[model samples]
Target: MNPTHDWSTTPVTTNLVRGAADLEQTPHGVLPHRLPAWARAQNTDGQLAMVESQPSGVRLAFRTGATTVELDVLPTKRDYVGAPPRPDGVYELLVDGRPARRATATGGNTLTIDMLAGTAETTPGPADTLRFEGLPDRVKDIEIWLPHNETTELGALRTDAPVEPVPGPGRKVWLHHGSSISHGSDAAGPTTTWPALAASRGGVDLVNLGLGGSALLDPFTARTMRDTPADLISVKLGINIVNSDLMRLRAFTPAVHGFLDTIREGHPTAPLLVVSSILCPIHEDTPGPCAPDFSEVSSGRILFRAMGDPAERAAGKLTLNVIREELARIVIQRAARDPHLFYLDGRELYGEADFAKLPLPDQLHPDAAAHHRIGERFAELAFGPGGPLAP
Candidate 1:
């Protein structure tokens, strides 16, 4: 598919993932828009089926002259009825910021860009993993873009470093969990997710558990994070839960404790950071997706695009402020005993001032530039020298 050439001049290195990288953005049961714009975009309606699974894209070009690079571009978010109905064309395989080749995305979320020596379209067998056979030494970095789906969770990094004891119990694995914002929504590509970008800068490894709508104090998810191996851990909570109105105040507090408790089981002494939701005026106080008449709608529907009025929140809903205050209270109580425990407000990463400078498109997710800003803050606060994530 030929991508729509929008030479309107954009940033060269955009944050592929919106806020965090550990978060996985799965379409799940969302409707696929065969709606017109779907034609111009790649994976306009694609999803990764399993939890914490690896999805691969095409490699654009490969060279061995002290460098080898591979990447494929796809669109993570799409609008059909409102925006133009043109499908996002095809995925463009780029090498060092240049369009080197093109990839036809198939299987909804599968597109391969191969540039090993000569050119070949390496396709996934769908039965096994999508592998990039041979990579040259000094590959420096791997960058990805999107015309297809951009919600990518890297399963493994096939390196020649041989499993030789990964050095000092590994580079202090940083485990993070959050919403789709953390799941690389509306970002550029996989490796460029905020978590991945921040990790690269901090020089650490990451295990992300960012689920779209499921981060709302789900025991199963917390169990998954608890069971997963890690050296350090963090949870960016509140936004999705409040927006979705998953649980009540009484339920949320214990759930938060339970979630942290579960994680502590595995990473007993690891540096654990608890992050509250960022600026979201709409559901910052509202507890749920309800009706205009102040009662629960029989329909289990959510107006993600709707702005939660002050009245709505006053009616007894969960807001970011409410969650953050509670989270702070929890962290203070926990930190008194657990020295490794820490709390960082998400807004400290992106606050009201930043909002004025760079407004969010839909008042929820920040754009690529904002992702970079947020990542920088996270890196400085959480992973910089003398920071909590440092060795």
Candidate 2:
């Protein structure tokens, strides 16, 4: 918008994107996807499609000497049908790998989701520009982390100076998959997501496939992870499975095996860590087809409750506790043949004491503070000197 500075338009290309699995060429610009086209095409679930396109750990990385940078983006923000208006998605600018400034775009599309009705509607709107100014006028590696939860369509990237794609950091590439909590949930910003934070502390590049309500051990997802190149891989299981009541214990055990087997096909020597869900009291022991507590709707706060009967575990219904036990057993059984495979109890990241201190705001997802806690814990447990992912 400043006429004094000569602005140069740069194309948003895959080389400039750090964390997305695919780049979708849209009319406006390139849209980053956490899942590749082939994998995305295999699933018809609206939630999966929407979340994979949210770009939780995705960022635009380039080297530039510009004091001012502007990006045009059309962000699709989510709106619960009856709850309070969700906050606008945040775009964080990082200079030389450190947080510099943050801004939020206005007047983009809105996706209204009615969980009760199991329906969603999108209302189109106009694109908005995010401008970052007053940077140090020397060449530096710059990264603009996209909103972790919003589905964003990127447009022209303008800078006062010419920009070129930055090379990778020469660190290990960590590919991770999980539920919405891993997808970012209520994290403060894109880079602050637990996985992102862990990757940062772990000194690794991240490819986050944390689909909201969609980490259902789908074969396509397994194949995606199998084919993607990564030095370290982790999958956080249980929460989404229990909440959706997608499968019983009988189905889940084999599904976990098949999923890991598929990944092993491509990454036989990569360090693979299987993580269970963090402590969620509601579904800790109770089997779920979790339902929203409409009683709190009038109070402008939405909470969830497990609806499945506790007695149903005897009938092979899956619960978080059951899933954790099964995952531990499976890892032990498989570790005999696969020495690189490891199991991490999700509770190690956020367990009973931590829950008492920093509880899950939604009874399912960790809040921003909890995200930081989980990230720090993960970095220590998995990336520490003697840890499983240590070099």
Candidate 3:
């Protein structure tokens, strides 16, 4: 928008992207995908489709001397039917690996999702530009972390000076998969997601596969992990399986084994960590099939509650406690043959004490502060000098 500045346009290509498995070219621009196309094609679940494209850990990395940078994006924002309109997703700019500035695109597409009716509708809109000015005039490593919760299509990227792709930092790559919490639910920004924060503290690169509501022990997801190259791997399981009531304990153990089996095929020697769900009081002892507590919908707030009876655990129904026990047992058994495999009680990351102080605001996902706590704990437990993932 400033005629005085000499702007140069740069194509948004794969070399400039990090933390995404694929870049899809769209009529408007390129869309980042957490899951590759083949894996996405294997499932048609609308929730999976939506979250995988949210770009939780995805970012555009480059080096430039530009004092001004601008990006055009067509962001598809999600709106719940009766709940309040979600705030605009944020774009965070980092200079030399530090938080620098933030911006948000206005007037883009909207995807209205009716949770009660189990339907979603998309409304098209024009692209919006996000501009950041007054950056340091000297050349620096710049990273534009995409919104963690919005489906964004990249358009033109403009800078006052020429830009080139930045090389990877050559840090250990940590590949992680889990549920909505891991997908950055309720986290303030992409770079602040627990995984991202942990990676930063641990001095590692991150490839986060945290699909909201879709971290069921799916074979395709396991296969995707098996094929991807990583120096470290982790799978956080249980919350989504229990909340969706997708399976009973009779099937969960074997599914988990098979999932690990697949991942070991490719990353046989990587430090593999199997983590159970963090403590959710509602599901800690009770079986789920969690349902939204719509009683407060009139106030534009929604909470979730477990729908299954406590007595049903007798029938091998799964709960957070039960899953934790199983995961620990499985990891111990597997560790005998695979010393690189390890298990972390998710509670170690976010447990009862932490919950007492910073409760999950929605009774499901951690807030930004809790995310910071969890990330710090994870870095200490998993990446510290004596930790399993220690280099």
lDDT against the true structure, each candidate: 0.53, 0.92, 0.92
* Candidate order (TM-score): 2, 3, 1
Segments in model 1 whose C-alpha atoms lie over 4 Å from true places = 1-170, 290-316
Tens-place lDDT per residue, model 1, 269-328, is 989999887786556555555222212223431124444565655445677888899999
Residue 43 lDDT in model 2? 86
- By summed lDDT, the worst window of 10 consecutive residues in model 2 runs over 1-10
Can you give the TM-score per candidate against the true fold? 0.63, 0.98, 0.97
Put down candidate 2 lDDT per residue, 237-331, tens digits, no spaces. Answer: 99999999999888999999999999999999999999999999999999989988877878788998999999999999989999999999999
**Which sections of candidate 3 miss by over 4 Å?**
1-6
What's the CA error at residue 373 for candidate 1, in Å?
Answer: 0.4
Residue 282 displacement in candidate 2 (angstroms): 0.5
For candidate 3, give the lDDT of residue 31.
95
